[model samples]
Target: MTVVGKFLPLLGWVLAGVLMAEPASCESWVDLNVGSELQRPNEQTVVDQTALVRLNTRYSAPVGITLNAHYGLAHRVRLVDEPGTGIAAAQSTGADLRLWDLPTELWRSDGDTWVIEQNLDTLHGVFYWGAQEFTVGRQPISLGVSRQFSPLDVVVPQRIGAQERSYRPGVDAVRWRNPLGLTGELDVGWVFGQDNLLFARATQQWGTVSAEFTALTLNQAQWIVGLSTQTFAGDWGLWQESAWLHDDVLSGARITLGADRSVWSDVYVVAEYHYNDVGDAENMTSDFFQKGLVTLGKQHYVALNASATPSPLVNLNLGLLHNIQDADTLLLGNVGRSLGNNTQVDATIEVPLAKQDSGTEFAQIPLRLAVLWSTVF
Candidate 1:
């Protein structure tokens, strides 16, 4: 069937929601963020800045609709991107996966030392029909159970060094959810961006543990079978997510096992171990940029993270990533404090423990310092 034929049914439900929505029952809000980053490599330094806005509205009903839109403008000076990789390229796929991207960059400039661009990042809605739910337009569809790395997150994969955690870049797509009893649900989705993607997940809650099974195909070029589970034991929580990827681009098994616990009222810690057999350990390839393989040129990795809330308004987080094959490590840190009830500021930094010419994962990545301020109104 043609694309429109598939969406005709979803549009019917959207029309139903439009006729049933009451204006007085609508809820709306806005959020803004401004950030500046300093990226220093062994060779040069680059400055990146951005301002982002999110406007959200929701109408309450059995068949509800939510409209969330994001607008962002980015300015970057001094281009020192690694070969075949850049932040703009990683996020270009945001929007709908089964159709097209919503990030319609209104205008952009590219130069040897500077770049400027703006776009609409997110625009999507949700509606329900009896026990079934449908989401359409542009939205973030994140899937994973791992804390540090998730091999099964093929929908909207997160960047390893990305500082923004508040938003999962939106993509264009349509999704459906059907409840299976009280503890289980079946999810199915389609995204068409650079390529067509179709995926599904069936989840079930067994006692205190939740487990999910997943399958996805990307433009007939790739196929993946995945599994994930989450459970807690006493004060310690544990989870695992794994996937077996098969494709002409790359094929192999990837997995991560993780555990976390609160050591005290103010501190929490987590440790995770990841391994993959398909990644090329000898070369710093753009596999992540081109093929969405986040193994990062290594077969084994260890991640440790901790968070502390010393006061009501102050918070700190630290993360350590070790690439086993390359013997290089990277440390990520963030400190934040509230300026008021509706405003906050955060400072983040990344330090690599290896020389930039060492051909290691962290070695090639530059040291980064960023400051971000956000407010809600």
Candidate 2:
């Protein structure tokens, strides 16, 4: 079966959903980006032997447009379409239909409601549902402790021309939010398809803190578990998230802690530390969840990130990151401004300092530059 093999179900779901709703509002956006990157692929190492790895340099430019429409049919059903940029299989587009406030008037106590949404693409089939306020499906999941990218969910890292990794798509799942007794939420997911993979995840909150766990079975063969948390202090926001991965034949772990505090109004600083311990170093960067055991480049790092909005259409971002264990470091700065009601341009550059006797990837003189233009209405 090819990649399209997984899209049929999603198509049917979305079409059926659109049919049940009436179109009401529409919006669309387009993005064009081109950039160059030098990537280093890891290889087997031998003691007393030197393995020289060279960077593979390349450039890519892609254009994508997404158009979405919402319909209010019978005051309960809504139609939606989220088409793709058609550049790559990983980022293909799709559609969906959502039904809200169905046949549960008695169960919808004051602040409670029920809804069901479905996607119309085999590559992304989602069965949406919820009770009193909780909903579940095979949709993409983003949890705590993440920056430009997520560390706990490190399955895929690049979001350029097209998607390249497997997304925990919409699946058979259940979620109950602020149920009759609980305060935060409760979710259970059991997914199975093509490759015959199974996954389960759950999350809850205590006062100002939230925690979660996720388990997955590969090809219905190996099992892995993860634990994570998020909280806020008096003047700062803090988080500690980690995963303990174990299969019948392998075991590994990863953890990251970060905090942000405001010094004054509209100005703040952020810092974080990430650690990894992978028994097989080769497994590093397999997925978002498997950073392995050693922080890639074995880093104890911190960053000072700040941003400001000088006008309605202009903004700036700056940050400096340094690794404590190695002499590796990164200096970042970027600015973005809107050109029109629906179009904007932005550029960013990352400059790396030379290594200091410590063999770290960031210590090398690595540089990345890029510009992007996006528009929507």
Candidate 3:
């Protein structure tokens, strides 16, 4: 079926539900964003422009049921000053670049200069009763302890440096959660697809500490177990997450440890270290584009991020990521300013540091600058 054919049916369903809902109980909003990026690598320069629109609506029925629907439209264009640069590199590398910035379900390429896409980010129904809730349809399910990187976020993991981090891609699934006690809960979910995912998680809290344990099965063949925890000591926050996968081909573990603290009431600093026992240091750069157990192919990684807000209207962020095995580093910096009540603007820059080896991970990335403008209505 065509993309429009698939979208029209979903749109009709949502509209029908909205019509049946109470008039004053439905809420809706539209968000628009425009972004431009410039990248330079070697002697080549590339420019990309993108526009995105999102329509979100929620309805609360009188009988404790809630419906949420979110739709998105996007258009992107890329221009390269020289051949064999930027996206060309990505294409030659055989990386699934579309997964990084575009939706996969409903999209089409328009000639060689433009790409248009549409997607349903969320279409879910929830039934709430006391401390128990059941959700069905497409929705996001996140499980982890770390904020920046999570080894245990196996279900619908967010892409690194994603533009829309607020919402991860939703999965077709059924999930149930119930409170175990005053400070505990149990969650179970099943995601349907070719490689189906089934998992159960238990969470507990004590004082200023919280912990979670999960067991998951993939395709009824591989098993994965995860543990994560977070605790507060004085003014510092500490977290750790670990996952172990049992498979014939890819059997190993990944772990991450992190700490964060606030300074001067307006500045926050965070540091994290990640270790992937299954990662390959020799093939780190080449294998990075391949689908694998580890998100990053290098064995060890360290990252530091700091954010400061000098005033209510402006925020500054700086971050650094280092690949210990390959000795490659990436520097990130961004500034955000609130334009008004419902608008904002941001500027960001990323610089990769590595030897002049085309195979190296950081060397393949260009120095990039991005400007973004967004507004909500």
Candidate 4:
């Protein structure tokens, strides 16, 4: 048997206990999406400095498929496939099977629940790890209390291979969670044999206000610090976040503030401003602070987004942005339609109404359209 094959059952058993102990109320759902973007030289979505800049936007779309199937054999044993392998040039399938809720009594006394959640993006199976209960394996790591700058987003699928979108494989590592009255986590990972990627986070609640802090060490480049606070006032929710990054050469900060109002059922409007200190002329750019650039370190912006779900199978989003530094403007519109229980389709278009003086001419006329189909069983 292959090495991976030999370890399957043991890993399955470990994952089962973790899932039953902390299972989130969920249902098995499979998602397949195909999308494309249009723009000019270096006018695509913002990413890290370590990533290559695409000179031209073309007919690129996510062609991959994923699945997560769970069978509750008993109250304590569930069999499942994390993301059925369908990702290699040689192997058309990327499937991994796991067992959930084995020997589920580990945390019955704690009044906490466990759920086994897996994604196609991270191929590794994660069980609660160590004394901290850290979910380990290939997983999504969201750092900080704010949404603007996420320094721990290494496993994003679109960043690794062209066939996948918003999916990424987890690095080999151990993660821990501390739930002793407060909630927090610490994670350590090795990417490309470099073991410097470390993450720590904590969140607390006090009456109507909450706060969170997140910090990280770059795999080989920098250190990041972030903090955020949020409060509810009447029908509006207000929040703010600030982050700083430092390394051997570069140094910068980002501040973001926003408010959201839910005036109706299942509908909301949000206004946010993100200001990035993207200048470090004396110091080289650090790898950890790459996604902050909406225009490659050229502009600051305030954006408004409105979202509504009219039904269980339909969703819509409308966005407008104004670049505070360069006076550029942007408009975006998107909609999604669910085709079945496991399949759906969506489309997005972004238009730049004004251009910055950075001299990237193609950024003036960025447009895109795409269609996708996916399934699981």
For residue 229, model 4's alpha carbon misses the true position, in angstroms, by 1.4
What TM-score against the true fold does each predicted structure earn? 0.85, 0.58, 0.84, 0.60
Clashing pairs in 1: 95-170, 95-171, 95-172, 96-171, 96-172, 97-191, 97-192, 98-191, 98-192, 99-192
Quote the positional error of residue 249 for candidate 1 in Å: 6.4
Which digits, one per residue and each the tens of the lDDT, describe model 2 over residues 1-377?
Answer: 54344764786676555644543332333233222222111221111111111111111112111122221111111122123211111121211111111231122122221222222211222223343433333334444454422334532233311111343323222333333347544544433333333445567788898877766554544455677788898998988777765655556666677888776576667777666555234654343223221235452556567777768889887877766666567777777899987667767666666533445656443354545554543
Native-to-model Cα distance after best TM-score fit, residue 242 in candidate 3, in Å: 1.7
Q: Which candidate is the best by TM-score?
A: 1
Model 1: runs farther than 4 Å from truth? 5-17, 20-24, 59-63, 74-98, 101-116, 248-250, 281-289, 293-295
Alpha-carbon runs more than 4 Å astray in model 2: 1-29, 32-139, 148-151, 157-182, 188-197, 220-222, 279-299, 355-359, 363-365
Model 3's alpha-carbon lDDT is 0.75
Model 2: lDDT of residue 171: 29
Model 2 clash tally?
34
What's the residue-level lDDT of 350 in candidate 1?
94
- Relative to the true structure, candidate 3 has a C-alpha RMSD (angstroms) of 5.0
Per-candidate count of clashing residue pairs (backbone under 3 Å): 10, 34, 0, 24
Better of 1 and 2 by TM-score: 1
User: Pairing residues by index, what is the TM-score of model 3?
Assistant: 0.84
